[model samples]
Target chain A: MQSELHNGINVDIQEYADLIEESPSFQDEQYAALVTSAQNLVSAARSARVTSYGSEEGNGHMGLCFYFPTQTDLDSTIGDAYADLGLSQASPIWANYVNSSTRTTNND
Target chain B: MNLVLATTILLFLTITILFGCSEDRVTRTGIEPEADNQTWGVLIYAAGNYEGDQLSGPSMSSSRAVATVRVMETELNSPQTMTQACLATPAAQGEVGIYDVEFSPRQPVGLLNSELVANLGSVSTGDPQTLRMFLETSLSQMHADHYVLCLAGDGHGWQGMMGDYNNELGMLIDKLREEIESVSYLLPGGKFDILALYARNMGTIENVYELRNTADLVLTSTFNVEQPHHKIIAEWYRDLQSQPELNRDELAAYMIDAERLAQDTSEAVFFTTLWNTNTMNDVAAAFDTHSAQTGLRPAQLRLRLC
Candidate 1:
């Protein structure tokens, strides 16, 4: 499970980096590092059974929460990022971060 | 020859008078002057906690009542304590106060006990239906310049949960709007001036937008819970009351800043407005201007997710 989670994170990071590079305006190293760090934190949390809960029958538990600085920050950053990348205003998957430790029940 | 001379002179005089009147007439172009007396009415409703005992419900109600009392005591011209302020007085005629009431579990339709019954000048409270009736009657009887409704409890856009069942915030706002609309019929010249709104997070934005077709402006926080910033809110209220010259847009901008500061704890703060498209840009420009004037760097915050 840990290796699988690590692989998933690696793939996501590569995709994010590719998207960032495609938009030359957001190629700054600071932005790249922030994304990478956040991804790693999420990946580590996902892999550890200490965070995730697995039921005896089969399925794994899932819960997610993102701790942004504030609602305004979230709005501005997401809006600006989407505008810079010429992306649509619909909700992006990047905003979702799983809180594995909080997961208690699993329904397969 | 005498009749022709008289008719010609009369025609010339009429033409001259018409031209002079046109030139002297007021065009009515500039902005209207602000009113002398500005009354801000804030109403907060917190109900539907049935599982708890009657005492618990009233306790929560009293907490909100205390908050309102504090805001009034500090911001209003009068300096009365909460208990004394609840009582009716000459100052109470123009003062800000809260009417808090709770209902017993068995008698959910009626009010258990009303605190401001004796001093029922302009403010009153009871069960939801009773409160609605009072507001409708009072608005019809009196003239209010500004109206603010702060619904303090759990609410979704169309659904609300105070205790067990779900209620509709939109419906409540609609009811209030209907009451106010009826009251407008009795005003002088059958018209009244409507100002902005300051409300809690529970469905305020949606509610404001729905009711604000008749109002001038609406201000609300984005969160769904109440984090009371009495000091800051009172200060902002005082600032607005003092500056009768500020326009609606300017007042809205100031409120955005106040909400941001109230919601944010860090040195840096951020805020957005659904009504004002250029609000963020204005805030950024203001920060830049202040920074240039003071030669100090504003606080920095990196956006991780938004």
Candidate 2:
């Protein structure tokens, strides 16, 4: 179902579903999206961890963990987790990454 | 004897006139004539393609306009190769003479990853080469007085590309620094007055030091990670063209105001500045005040590392 939330964010669960159904590329790859997302997540995680070390060399490392995930499982988990933390579904950076990754994985 | 002397004088005058005319022709066509001392030069470097991201909005139509205005205001002459009417000429005889150049490449959806990698490589290669070429050509030509570089595009400091899925902003900055140093080595005495970056997501305090290390001043937007508002930017260019004395802080304040107006019905707008120690810190301070007034937190990223 598609719905608009109070914080000016929009959520369309079916839109995610449609993306999976339509992508031919997603069909061709064997867990390609999953791998891509995992890589991104790993990179982001590493960046975040480095920054968390409080070293001067890692000052701008916070943004590293904030990347698009390519894996479906990770996408769903992260999305749901963020949603629980109050990030709206309409947030393009996080939501789009999650939706696209999930769609690619579902199609495969 | 008097008639002979008069005839000789007339012939000499005629020859001199003809030679002068020929020289003028050569200067007008083959070479740029010497500009007056009052003339200044501006170079605009528009780099990094975003394929129109959601946060930053869309690609700008008036980037060319900004370049053009800067050129016209400075009354400098641009290269024949940069035939665009709005682009300014190089400076006559200063560090500002050498200007770096970079361009963004177009990309489609599925090709984002590969395209990003390829373009990053090209950007790196082009960045240094462009600066080096500008320095060589400017010094040899000796036509510029000071140099100003405008790195126009979507920017996010320390982070890779802001709007695009493929770009790494950190990598791009590193490449730019490398190229700047390379150019500096080639032209040890030359100077870059400022590096005006027309981009987004780089308004915070942290980005300032990283950016200011390479250039005298860094001008960019604070938030709204998409393409900047065209009319606002055009207007800003117009103002700068009319009044070159406008300090960097004044420019930052204006950008913050524009950002506020643009984001009134949307999201928060932010921006900041990093100036060389010699530059007036008032501009950065003004930017902070404006950002705070608009409920946007100013990242105090200014440091004296260089």
Candidate 3:
């Protein structure tokens, strides 16, 4: 089971490294090694069994969480704060996607 | 006469330079002479009033803060102790106090049981300056070989934490990073040994990246933090007392092992993970690259995972 998890993490790491390779700034062996380490940590976290509220089967808690908010939440003051985050500011594509989604959600 | 005048001017300039460069020139030294340097000092910036109604009773947030202090008190060995924990929280009517966590066997006593070491007059926990002051005062007075800063309050991942309605302030992640960095600048090591987030949803890459330079290791939860982890920390405290030289990696591994043990013993699922902040920059950059390439909206990614 551990080997299988390790394999899955390697695949994810390779895919992540490939994406970074496309970016000119991060095209280095050091970046690849760091990505591998992070993915391994994330995989170890996801392999752990999490249980919430006395139920062992339905705990949805993952090892590493990302900022994914509902459209309403994204439109609120909290969303304003989220948009101002360094990550959001760094990734214009992500920011644009969020902005477009908010627009689409509002139109709907 | 000219020679005597030159000599006297040189002597006056030397005295002026000595006084100007003296430590006594700085007001509010933020140090306590009575505080003995210990192996580990844990400072908890606990804001209790952020979660529940102030009129009814102690909020769940405040209750958790009290429970955490109690757990520390139970594990702390007095008279020959190498671990010192302090609780800094808002008291009645806009008053904030940093209390010394002492070993007390009395039943049902809350934060009042601890000794009031420093009273920070009329400050909101939501303010970044308040956090800086708390850290500066505690770091100077606690006097530890290493330090673990525990932020115990309500959190919404990267949005904010430790909100104060009275002061109308919210402590954003950026402000938190700056506050910790400023305090670290004053420390000998220039960073905290460990930064433990007792709040929820703080394990996100962005939040961790923001705090990368503040601590060697960041201990936080991806979801709600379990109460059992407090006991895990207390256990680590006991281990620290025995070893007194546990490195950051060793301490992180020990806490992770304790979490795994807690999970094995019961149905409670814990999402606590420790990340080396040194590696967070590359992780965050890689994540940004992946996000840009995928062109997936944050919500859509969540939906796809679900």
Evaluated with lDDT, which candidate comes out highest? 3
Rank list by DockQ:
3, 1, 2
- Give a tens-digit lDDT track for model 2, residues B1-306: 999999999999999999998776445423553333312344444332333322233442223323323333233222321211111111111011222221112231221111110121222212345444443444343333344455555565434222222343423444455555555533323445455555665543334433444555555544435444343444544455455455545544554454344334233333333334222233233323322222211111111110
Can you write out model 1's per-residue Cα lDDT over B1-306, one digit (the tens) per residue? Answer: 999999999999999999865443211101121122334333333332222111223332233433433454334331111112231112233222324321111222212222342333343221244334544443432333444433333333322222212222323444445544554554433322332232333322224333443344333333433444343355555555456345545555555566544444443222223232113223223223322222211112111111
Clashing pairs in 3: A51-B269
| Candidate 2 deviant stretches above 4 angstroms | A1-108, B1-39, B53-144, B159-170, B185-190, B204-206, B227-233, B244-268, B274-306
Q: Lowest-scoring 10 consecutive residues by lDDT in candidate 1 chain B?
A: B78-87
Two-chain complex of model 2, DockQ on C-alpha atoms against the true structure: 0.02
Task: Supply the DockQ value of model 1.
Answer: 0.03
Supply candidate 3's per-residue lDDT for B283: 59
Please give the lDDT score at residue B131 for candidate 1.
39
Candidate 1 residues lying further than 4 Å off, grouped into runs, are A1-108, B1-62, B78-128, B137-149, B161-173, B186-209, B229-232, B244-247, B265-306
Per-residue accuracy of model 3 over B16-85 as CA lDDT, tens digit each: 8888655332211112233365656777776655543222234323355555666665555432233333
Q: Which ten residues in a row have the lowest lDDT in candidate 1 chain A?
A: A86-95
Task: For model 3, state the Cα shift of residue B298 in Å.
Answer: 4.0
What clash count goes with each model? 1, 34, 1
What range of 10 consecutive residues in model 3 chain B has the weakest lDDT sum?
B25-34
